[model samples]
Target: MFVPCHQKLVSAFLLLYCLHLSAFDFLWPCPQKCICRQDTLEVNCSSKHLTVVPEGLHISARRLNLSGNRLKTLIRRQFYGLTQLEELDLSGNIISMIEVEAFQGLKYLRILKIKNNRLKIIPVGVFSGLSSLLSLDISKNEILVFLDYTFQEMVNLRELNAGENDLVFISQRAFVGLQSLQELNVDHSNLTSIPTDAFSQLQSLSKLRLRRLNINVLPNYAFRRLHQLRTLQILQWPSLETLNSNSLVNLNITSLVISNCNLSAIPYASLRHLTHLIYLDLSYNPITSIESNKLGELLRLQEFHLVGGKLLRIEPGAFRCLAHFKLLNVSSNRLTTLEESAFHAVGNLQILRLDRNPLTCDCRLLWVMRRRFRLNFDGRQPTCSAHERGRRREFRDFSEAEFSKVFICRQAGILERKLQDVMVDEGTNVQFECKVDGYPQPSITWLSPQQTPFSSVGRIRVHANGTLEVRYAQVQDTGTYLCIASNAAGNDNISASLHVRSSSRNYTPPNFFDESLVETSLPPSTNSSAQLSSPFPFDAKTIVIATTMGFLSFLSSVVICFVFMFLWSQSKGQIKHTATIDFVPRSSMGGGGEGGDTGRFTMKLI
Candidate 1:
């Protein structure tokens, strides 16, 4: 049994040695100055004080780490045997010139990282033989620009990272045959401008990170045929104070981040045409204001984050058309107030973030604070600095429970409001009183059903007696209308509905008691077949009814006729139109623009 076990152990040793030889071909009789370790599948011939790589590298080796070496140039005969190599690391080397056909036989090479090299210009067709290259990291090199076809035939290349290089001008069609490219990072390069039609054929490019390039202007149609681009980060251009509107006309992107630059204002009108954007980040800019209804055209936008921009004030209704949003972050600004109806389209909002901003504790902030739910904040120093008695103090120190403590100082009381549940027909005048409890007389403003605020006018008037009156109310005004009553102390708001009563659209004169009768009824003794001939009869039983109906009709006719005659007579006469003008004295109107207290009045009608 011992002899048989010895034989089995010998057989196992032989099988393992053959497997090791197949993995590292440079073993036993290793290459001149290279030491191939079969156990680790690693060749550490790097920085061996050699000027050139000896021949006969492992054909089955998967990786060769040649960093920290003194190889100034590459010849084809050195790497002519590495057929199964997938990863080649030549980092921290002095590779100055890469001869043509240097990598001719490495068809299955996937990764090539040549950081901290000394190549000034890469020749064409240098990497054309790497058909299976996936990722290439050539950072920290002195490459200024490469030939147009330096990386021509890399069909399966996915990511190319050439950041931290000295690239000033790139040749058009530099990255032509890289069809499988996904990510390209060339940030902090010295590129000034991208030539038009530079990226005309990269149909599969996904992410292009060219942030912090010395790019002053991106020429029109610079990114023309990049239809499948998903993410674009163009930021940190301090000299870029403005963008010509035609720079990015039609880009099919999902996330567009432009921040940390010196842009005074984003031309929202230019971006109103991008119909496929979903996430937009325009923070860290110097934009001061956005016009109302800006960003109203981005129909599919869901996440809008604009923070760290030195914005003084956003005009009310600035984010007019950005509805159906999921997350909106507008914090870290210099804003003092948020009007009560700040979040206009808050019906579908889920997350509203407002942190690290100088929010004045006033009635204006009460509107947004009353609705902020699950608001995320900085927990370490999460305190809202507010002005209090004689000085500024920290209030609401980032606690969920404390945020519920509304800090209203000397505001109005809970002014009671109620609505009458009475039904009225259409075209009838309706009136209601707006009552409130305050030290100052309450001034009221009404808003129509369609979210339009009302003004005191001829048709819809508000009397000094605090009564809201509307004449000839139409069916379109059949919805809940808001009434906001406010004075110096605070404000109180409520809504009232005016419903028009029309015969229900479904109301059919059901089969009358006599279905065969052509007319409704007649003032007779159970007569079903006889039609109401003249709608009235001067009979004994119907005399009183006929006389009453005649009186009402005559009265209505007299009122209509009187109104028409009065209007006609007034039209025919020399009607003198009165104009009320109380001109302010020159001395009294010295400083004020409108109010001079000289019984000031002016009238003009359209």
Candidate 2:
């Protein structure tokens, strides 16, 4: 191939220009002020004093965070070439408007968050080519109303959050094409009434939250077409006064919450078709009473919360039909009594809250008090004045003697106790105590491993306070000791092992029982009124035992030392030690408790 000299020069210059451009793009994929993560393909331009979207970004970038900037408007092709972007966060920007086809080629985007921006109107076709979009959060913006096809291009969208916007009226077809949407949040808005066909296209919607809206009434059959809906929450709607009959008919929801509404009674007819409902929360309402069979058709209901209502009474069989009911909260109410049959058929009840009610003390709550020991009804049981005594006291604190006239009560069984293992050296003492609390004043007795009664011997004693003490312990005292507390209700026992080890090298103790001691050496009387003025107030028997144990321990130590010295003396000179010095203090001789003495202590070793 032959080429002219001038043509070759032109081709070489063009190749050099292309190479320089490639080098520039490789060295700085993002703006100097922004931070780029090459490994994760993420670009963070947040708070970078940027006024416009950076022109060039890594082609493989997946997440782009452009929040906290002064970008005012998003023109067409602002994000021209980033095709692999899956998450784009443009929140906390001053973007007031967006041109149509602004995000033209972001076909793989799944999550787009433009919240906390100044966007007032979503121009049609703004998000045109976001085919794989799943979640779009445009909350906390100045958007007033939804125009037709505003979000029509995002067909794959699943979650839409338009909360905290001034959405006054939603056109009938505003959210028409969002067939895959499952959750819709329009809370904290100024929506007065929801059109009957507002949600006509949302067949797959499962969760709908309409909190802090000023809507007046929920129209009839408002949610009849949403067969897959599982949750509907309308919270903090102070203006929600009337709910028409059959408004919520033919629904299969599992949970429904209508909190802080001003309804005086439950709209039972409206909820008759929710047969599959499991949780219903009507908290902060003014519902006065709960009638029998009002919600009987909801057989699978598990938790029903009527907290902070003005409930006066719960009629018989109020919760009889809920076979699988687990929790019932009626706290902060004005109920006086619960009919005996209110919870007749609710066998699966696990938690029942009835605190903060102005209940009157009477025999109506006798069953509740008895069942308290079985159920986990640990919420505050009300305090009321005793009918006979006219004094206020807690429900559990009322004694069986006080309530004997009301009903025949049985004794309480053993609930809980603690027994610890005893470990000590031989010749040292050990004390084992057992505490028991039950009705009819349980009788406590200690026994050995052979199930025989513990004998009160010279080195063993059972105090009246349920304490067993063993003095001058031996290796034979290592065995299981059982404490049996018996009453009319039942008998419960706990056993603990005592381990007594020898004070010698490589000496592991064996577990044994010592029942050979005589049964005549009982302890002294335990008077309750004895007071001492000094710190070291030791009794005569305790002092004698302590001194004898101490002297024996010292003598054993000295004998061991003498044996070692005698062994060493065989290899060297004999080592002998002697000491003799004695001087009696004048105070000990009863000389006005003062002493001035001098003595010379002598020691001789050979």
Candidate 3:
């Protein structure tokens, strides 16, 4: 074993020479102008107008980027010593066709992104021995159809982006062994809705962007096993027109952004039952009106942005139960009025933006506007009529500055709205007058408790706002009455009451009474005994005058007693009524308004 060092070297040299001769004998001749790089042992003579694979490589380079070169065909057994090759990206070359088993010995390849290349179809078994492959991206190519198991031996493949390819139909079990696949992005491509359970085996998967596709109706339980997913963003889908409450049947997703749909409406119960939702985006839709009771059920909602939807009206008790809400944006709409008491329960309003709408302003908002204005430096005072005479208009104009002025300034120069007057009487004509302000005169309409607009009755007449008169009121108008004066900012309403008072006996005689009939029963003896004769002496003509005076006094006494008795009865009836209510509820519309006293809301809601 201990031979001379020179002898051992000579023997090793001969052995290496024989092996080199044997390898060179079978290998093809190296192409001209091709340089075998010493470090990687790869022949990189591409893009020099060569027609065949460069042979006689150094056989060490395992990876190659021979893209951006011209080579038409991959000859059989064209790469014999490239067994150590792991990954390849032959995308930009002019290579058009390849025979099967083109990569028979590239066993260690892991990832490939051969998208955006010009190939008509991928040959079968093109990647058969690539057992260690983990990912592949063959999207954005002109390949029309795929042979079964185009990725048959890529057992370890976990991700694929085969989107944007021309392959229409993928044979079933085409990617069966890809059990380790976790993420796939086949979006923005040709396939429509997925057949039922097409992704059932991808339990380890989490996210997929299947929106903006060709399908109109989403098949039921389409996402049956995707429970691990947390977010699904269905954005700008052109053909998607409808979505039932059960569309998200199998999803426990935390967030959903279903914006820009073709929905006519949304049920309040539909949104309220998604109890686990913390954020939801429903903007740019065609929902016309929201159910008054719908928004109240979503107590956990934090933000609601309806940027470009067309909302016409909100019901009286619409948002009565949105307790912890923070932001509500109802911009770019056609709303003209707001009720003063609608926000009575919304005490925690921090930012309420109602900009760029035609709002009518008037004094009827003295209460609500004044209170809202006092909230902060930025208060919104609904615009009101400025000039008292000559075609009184609502708010002259609406601007951000005007809205800010209403906020900073506690009161507008003119009370844009009038106080509402509640009447409790039959046929009690209530006139709700308000001085609205705007470019043109604001139109005034009576808004009933039922939220219906009523034109003025002959009994009720509205002047600019100097005064409102309720004539011959009965007990029927006992309910609340609001004088809604509107222009652009919003409508202002004032509430007052018409009380039907029970009739009382007032037998007040004429102011000028004669001083003649004065015959006192106890003072007659005292006045005659001393310096005066009989105060009402009973002599002949004197006796006649005295008797007449006495008779008159007796008659006057009886009349006073009767008047007192009648008054006592009226007072009793009044006491009984006061015990019930200021305005009688049983009173019908405009029933018992027999004019007594009118009350005003001096202090605003603030």
Each model's C-alpha lDDT? Answer: 0.71, 0.80, 0.56
Looking at model 3, residue 563 earns an lDDT score of: 100
Q: Per-residue CA lDDT of candidate 1, range 325-392, in tens? A: 67767678776544534344766666655667665554455544555544433332223455443124
lDDT of 2 by residue, 93-192 (tens): 9899899999998989999999999887787788889878999999999888888777777788999999999888787878777989999999898888
Q: What is the TM-score of each candidate against the true structure?
A: 0.60, 0.60, 0.47
Which residue pairs collide in model 2, if any?
478-512
- Leading candidate by lDDT: 2
Instruction: Determine the C-alpha RMSD for candidate 2 after optimal superposition of all C-alphas.
Output: 28.7
- What TM-score quantifies how close candidate 2 is to the native fold? 0.60
Using lDDT as the measure, name the better of candidate 1 and candidate 2. 2
Runs of candidate 3 with Cα error greater than 4 angstroms are 1-53, 56-58, 71-81, 94-99, 119-124, 144-152, 170-172, 230-236, 252-606
